[model samples]
Target: MDIAIVGGGAAGFMAAITARRTNPSCKVTIFERAQKVLAKVEVTGGGRCNLTNSFAAISDLKQAYPRGYKLMKRLMMTFNHEDAYRWFEEHGVPLVTQDDDCVFPKAQDSHAVIDCLVQQAADLGVMVCCKSRLMDIRSMQDGRLELIFDNGTQRIFHRAIITTGGSPKGNNLQYLARLGHKIVPPIPSLFTFSIRDKAFCNLMGTVVDPVVMTIPGTKFRSKGALLVTHWGMSGPATLKLSSHAARMLAEQDYKSPIAISWTGERSRQEVEENILAMQIANPRKQLATLHPFGLPSRLWVYILSKLGLEAAKPWAEIGRKTFNRMIETLVNDQYTIMGKSAFREEFVTCGGVSLESINSKTLESKVCPNLFFAGEVLDIDAITGGFNLQAAWTTGFIAGSCVAE
Candidate 1:
């Protein structure tokens, strides 16, 4: 069987290797537009290549993906995180989990992971042809797939897999849509909002753990670590919220105001009660000198300043009105988002090939027989951590096994 996989990224390469491993006699070929494979893997996770998450259960793993959570749940039951780790371990690539459950190469080098995939592909007799841009794909009358390359080259294959990733590069989706597959409108995900507030100007390096972030027009809320950058707010919480609200944010022109609760564990009533207790405990002490709720003294002062509270005011001297205002600001701090910042080296997009046209179990297209899809190319995206890469591995493995069968 001749199988041609397009876009030699994580999913494409993995599928090629999996197909060859499942059937040694199968001719597996990967056509990468770039001269190198795993370009994204090299820069992912600051070059460490966060391989897979430590989450073992399919139920918990599905929560990481906002787009295809339900569909991925069924798929992950077949090839979950443990399966991925074992697959790499058996292939001579050992993985170590970080403190946050993100798995990476024990050597902490993305090239090591990339080398493992490349070497494994070679060992499995999978042919990787670089600089071969697939221009078009056509289904022949004899039930074979015909691929036309940019260099005026054409190849016929018994099966083809489209794993060209998202719209980060170009209009690769158009090529696939022309081949009769539905393509979802691509949108940016896992991005930070650019807030137009000076209070967060000097807070570029400040990190707030367990922050509750929410979109204004929606009831979506995420609690995780948040970082205040010079551009705006970022980190796990913001990125996760962005993934779930990518389409909503895009429709609003990225100008929606977001509400942030730094004290994620406490509600407005709880915060007010705590402040009242603090005032009673330290009646004679100045409010500025006593940092309540263990927040940074600087942040406490900033919040007081925003609430128009005098730093030198004694706890007893603070009026009920001012105290209520302070509590309100602390619980429901609002910031107008002006734009979006791609999380430096980390950018996970939310749109790709429509999942409805693909078989969730086999990663094969329902519209075209023998056509499979995997990785970021599908309309599936996850939050930060190792979720995105794990999706790739799972889908790739399934496609490989299905194609080989």
Candidate 2:
């Protein structure tokens, strides 16, 4: 069988290698638009290339994917994180899991991971064509898939797999959709919110731990570390909420009000009681100098100012109304998200090809026989920490294995 894999990204490369491994006599070709393959993998995780996550069960892993959790649950059961780790280990690329369960190459370099894929494909006689852009694709009268390249090159294959990622520059989706497949509109995921707050200026390095961030009008909430930026807030918590609320935020034109709780572990009543105890412990101390409840001193001052409380006033002199206001700000700090900043290292989309169109068992298109889908191209995206890449590996392996047979 002659197999044509579009997009020389993580998914495409994995699919090519798997196809060749499953059927050594079959010819597998990977066409990449860019001069370099795995561009995102080279820069992902700050050059570490978080390959997979440590989540064991399909149920636990599906929680990270908001768009295609149900589909991913079924796909992961076939080839999940453990299988991915073992595949890498067999190929001489051992992986290590970090404290947060993010798995990376033991060499601590993305090039190591990319090199493994490149070498594996080469060893399996997979043709990796770089800078070969797929301009169009059509199903011939004989039921073969023909691909037209930008450089006036054409090739026909028995089967084709599209794993071109979620970039607007690529023609993978357009060409595949022209062949008659539903294309779900893609949106930016795993991004940070842009806020118009001056308090965040010159405080770009300030990070608050264990903060709860939520998007109003949506049932999205995340608790993790948050960073204050010149434009607004960022970090794990903000990015996770942004991903889960990507569609909602886009519908609002990225101008949505977000609520943040600095004390993620404490309730409003608990915060108020803690403040009362601090006030009793240091009645004569000024609010600015007291810095109660373990929050950042600058943030405490800002919260007091927002609550209309004088920072120089002693703790004993503050009225119950002001105390309540401060409690409210600490427990429910609100910020208007004016825009979004792409986490350029690993920006993923939450939606793509509808799951209903693909068979979960083999990742083969239910609408088209011998045509498969995988990776971010298939309406499946997960939060950070290598979950998205794991999905790609899983679906790509399944598609390649089933197609090769």
Candidate 3:
């Protein structure tokens, strides 16, 4: 048996390794377009390599993905995050789960993760061909896959697994579409919003408690630790919102009307009452000195300044009208998102080969028998953290395990 895996990322490498393990008679080869294999793995998690999440159960793992949640739930029974973590540790890569539930090599270097996969493939006799860009694939009448590369090279294999990680462009998927499979037009996911607000941008690096960041006129919203970046808003909250609204915001051409509620549903009247009480309690304190509602001191100062309030002014001297304005700014702040920035560490595309066209059990293509799909190549994506990598591991393992059978 011969197996060919395309695009040597996390899923590609995993598929190659598992294919050899399941059936020793099968010869596996990885075709990577780049000069080096596992390039993304070398920089994931800021070089720590978040291999998989530490979800206690497969059911918990499914919730992390927005695109393939239901499908992944069924697939996780065969191979999941726990299995992935164990596989790594069993291969001489010491693992540690951080407070954030992300597993990484104890050395905290992504090269360690990359080296383990490369060396494992070498030991398993899996051939890796870098700079071999797969230009087209055809299902031969003899039940073989014929792959043609850009270098004018061609190979025929009994089975094939496409582990090409997400592409930001839809045209990049034309080769897969040629296989008569539906392509879910690829779009960006796990990105940061580029807000043009000076008050917030000036206070870069300020991380505040979770807030309800909603795209006005849509149901997209997320609440998590939001970091104020010089470019815009980032961190868990913004990244989650981006994944959920990947296509919707793209339709808007990346210019979004962003409305952020620091306090969720705490009515304006409630905020007003809190302000009145604070004024009475700390009459002598400066408005800037009094950081209310648990907002960062720097943020509070900026909000008050943006509201045309004097920092040195005593709370007692503040009038009801000014207090309401300040409350509104803090509770229901708004900004115009002029653009977006790709979050380089684990950036992903939300669209690819339609999941409906895939066989959920073996990851074999219903449209193209003996041809398998894995990782972001399928229309599967998840939010930030380690969910995306988990999907890659899951689909890759299932494809490699079942291709020979």
Candidate 4:
């Protein structure tokens, strides 16, 4: 049996590996358009290749995905984080989980993961044909599928798995759309908001506790540790907002007002009370020197400057209006986002082949039988950390197990 996997990414590779193991007699081949495979995995988590997360509960894991959460209910139940951990370790890749619950290979490098997957594929007789871009896919008269390649090569496979990752353009998925599937307009997710404010640029590298970030006039909001990047605000919180609000932000052309509360869980009144107490406790202390609310020294300094207050001004000198202004700046600061850029190249998309067109139970296309999908190719994406990779692995594993020889 000739089984063609039309991608060489994490999901495609996992599908290939699964198919080969499930039916060892079947001939499996990965058709990748790139010069090499696992390009995204090689760079995920800054080259550490965060393979999976340590979220033990399905409820916890289910919350991370912005789209396809309902569709993934069965998929996650089938092969979740625990199963992923055991699979890698059982396949000879030592794994480690950090306090943050991100899982990475013990070797502390993406190469370790790429090598492990490649070695396993090679051992299982799965051929990874790089630079073999699929130009078209058509059903044959004999119940087979014909894959036309850019290089003028063609192959007839008894079954096929479409694990092509998220495409930045809708035209890229036109071939699949022609196969009777609906394409959700793809938009960038898990990205950093581009704030043109000079103060934001100057505050690069500022890491703060979980901040409550929200898109004005939308139900989109998230709370997590935020990092001020050279480009813009990134880190877990911002990325989560981006993922969940991808469509809303895109509709606004990426230009929108954002509200952030430095005191993540605290209400504005709570922050105000805390600041008032600090003033009474340390009347002679300089505002910047006091670092109210335990904010980072640099961040506190910036907040003061942003409010047009002198850092050396004593707490006692803070006027009633200025005090209220300080409270607002700390708990209700607003910034206009001009644009966005990929959050490391791990940028995911909330849009893809609509989840309704596929069978969640088998990861197969209801529009076209024998044609399956996994990973970002489907309308499934999650926020930062290792959730995206976990989805890819789970879907790929399911597709691989279900595909016929």
Count: clashes, candidate 3 = 0
Best by TM-score: 4
lDDT (tens digit, per residue) of candidate 4 on 206-225: 99878999887878888889
User: What TM-score do all the candidates reach, one by one?
Assistant: 0.96, 0.95, 0.94, 0.96
**Tens digits of lDDT, candidate 2, 1-405:** 999998898999889999998999999999999998999899989999999988843346445888888877787777888899999999999889888888999999999999999999999999988899888877777878888999998898999998888854334467666666777778898898888878654567778888998877778898888988888888888887887888888888999888988888788888999989999999999889977557788777778777777889999998888778788888888889899988888888766677878887888877667788888888888888898898889888988888799
- In TM-score terms, candidate 2 sits at 0.95
What are the candidates' C-alpha RMSDs?
A: 1.7, 1.9, 2.1, 1.5
Please provide the root mean square deviation of candidate 3 (C-alpha atoms, Å). 2.1
Q: How displaced is residue 204 in candidate 3, in Å?
A: 1.8
Q: Cα lDDT of model 1 overall? A: 0.86
lDDT of each: 0.86, 0.84, 0.86, 0.88
* Regions of model 4 farther than 4 Å from truth: 56-62
> Which residue runs does candidate 3 get wrong by more than 4 Å?
56-63, 263-274
Model 2 segments more than 4 A misplaced = 56-62, 169-172
Error of 3 at 3 (Å): 0.6
Candidate 4 TM-score over all chains jointly? 0.96
Better of 3 and 4 by lDDT: 4
